[model samples]
Target: MRKRNVFYSLFFFLHLLQQASSDVHSISGYFLGSQGLNLPDYMERITVDDVGMYYYDSTMNAEVPCPEWLNTTEGQEHWKDINLISLDNRHRFASSLQSAILQFNLTGSSSNVNVYQGVGRCSLYPDGTLKAVLTHAFNGEDFLSFDIDTKTFIASVPQAVIYKRQREENPVFLEHLTFFYKKTCFERLKILLQHAPAVNMKKVPEVRLFKRTKAGSKVLTCHVTGFYPRDVQVEWVGAGLQSVEEEMVDVLPNGDGTYQTRRSVIRPEENPEEHKYSCVVHHSSVAGNVTKTWEEHSGLAAWIWISLICFFLAIAGTGLLFRRLCKTKDVGI
Candidate 1:
């Protein structure tokens, strides 16, 4: 059963790789909320063509100067009001918000395009009160909570109002953002993806297997290098032919634009010889999956084997030489 599961996993991984390779465009965006001692809870930046198009600095309570292409008169005017609102409510609450997020994302393919936008705000007050709100623009969902029994509004309304007004005024803000991003960003990305110089390209992976001793235990590692697209799946199959737990390190970039990743599994010490391991790598560049089996030949073992072989050969040669000399002596006598 475990063997069957391993094969099924390999098959699914290969199918995923094929589908990923056929994809032409890739797009991703992130909205992160962090707590800082000296910084604001909310911040955002948008990039296009590898250039920053728009930035909002919550600490400064202002929108930084954008790229010329995005600095249209209308955009400037719109942000002016938004910035004013941000500044007005910058210090209204006694306690700062723990975290807040406002993010938008767009991804496109030949057949479909996906867009997502969301906002979330959470604040803790000095009077042991908490307030939070989360909104998803794509599905028109809003979640809010507060722990206060007073008439005073503990949270700011300007940011929420501005977002709501923007959505109302421009029903397709996500679509427009996607369109603008494609016009300014996707073109360059496409060119980079298609025309990556041959000198900077790697078509096949170089795989290596080795063992390391750490904390008196043996660790087996599969090192894969010189692969393109930066998305590769690696698995370790133990003696039972089941996928073993492995720790995969982050993928690091090579000087020539290829990528490298490492996966490792801890080898059990007891009956280590009875346990065999194999590393399987799946990449789009390779037609089929690559598998490498582990060998138990340690450096010391290899040296001992070579030394024994040489010693036996030396003894046999010496005996033959002595016999030849004795034959010569007998003939002379």
Candidate 2:
């Protein structure tokens, strides 16, 4: 019985392992190098499964050859040491390489210093699970991870490497490394800010109110366009109060490289005028939340105004005809 129980436990453990492995479909590593205001920056990306390697010149937006060392026998042997057979292992090696490149580009004693950045990413299929680790030479030895599922960021290194590195007792060397890491981190942040999307709040979203004829309900839609940096918040405010539930659509890309999103609210059997409905938008580009109120105009109300105007015109026309006939009769007599 004990042996049977152990067998069952082992099977369950293996099943969990298989499940975890199936969750991740592909892994990739990326590196980018840039000098201040320099054209033809260097970029390289490698994926484990599809598109094994890529090298490009950023300024010209053209493909380029891999580094000379990578083509050598020693380089090939070093690549084999990274064990690129397994996707997960490939990403690990790629991350280490990224870190090495970043350090070399950013920390080296060169007259024309350049910034290097590297990223290791694992992507899961169907479930849209993404795990990404980013390393910058400026940060010293630390790396940051982002989990798409939880929307959280974590900063750290592998436990085994941390233990090994901590055992080294050279104070001066350690201090120098620390200083270089801090400097690298600063430069990386500066480069990121320089490339960040610019904010423009000149064009506000348009809000429209539409009534459903059969359901006797009103729908308020907020249409926002011509926005950058994809991350935008849209909300619905009802009668000066917060809406309990609001439905929002995903942000879509435009032809011009901008982004747009929409939010909508449905109020049933309620007079649109009696209860105010406002669409509020929040974006990094804007100083504050932009709010637009809904103006109600029903088809029945429009037709009623048109009929009243036509009736008044018809009455005036009949009065003029009667006065003209009276003058004619007087002249004939």
Q: Which one wins on TM-score? A: 1
The collision pairs in model 2 are 138-184, 138-185
Cα lDDT tens digits, model 2, 1-333, are 533443453332222111123224444445544443233344444443222333333444322433443555544443443232223333434444345445344445443433334454444455754334444332223444433333333435442243224323455644543442334323322332233222212344433434333234455567787764456688777764322254547666454435566766666455655766677888666788778766554444765665665566666786765555434422210
Write one digit per residue (lDDT tens) for candidate 1, span 82-167: 35434433332211222122322222332221112233233323353433333332212121222223211222343344344433
- With a 3 Å backbone cut-off (N, CA, C), the pairs that clash in candidate 1 are none
**Residue 17 CA error for candidate 2 (Å)?**
30
TM per candidate comes to 0.39, 0.35
- lDDT (CA) for every model shown? 0.46, 0.44
What TM-score quantifies how close candidate 1 is to the native fold?
A: 0.39
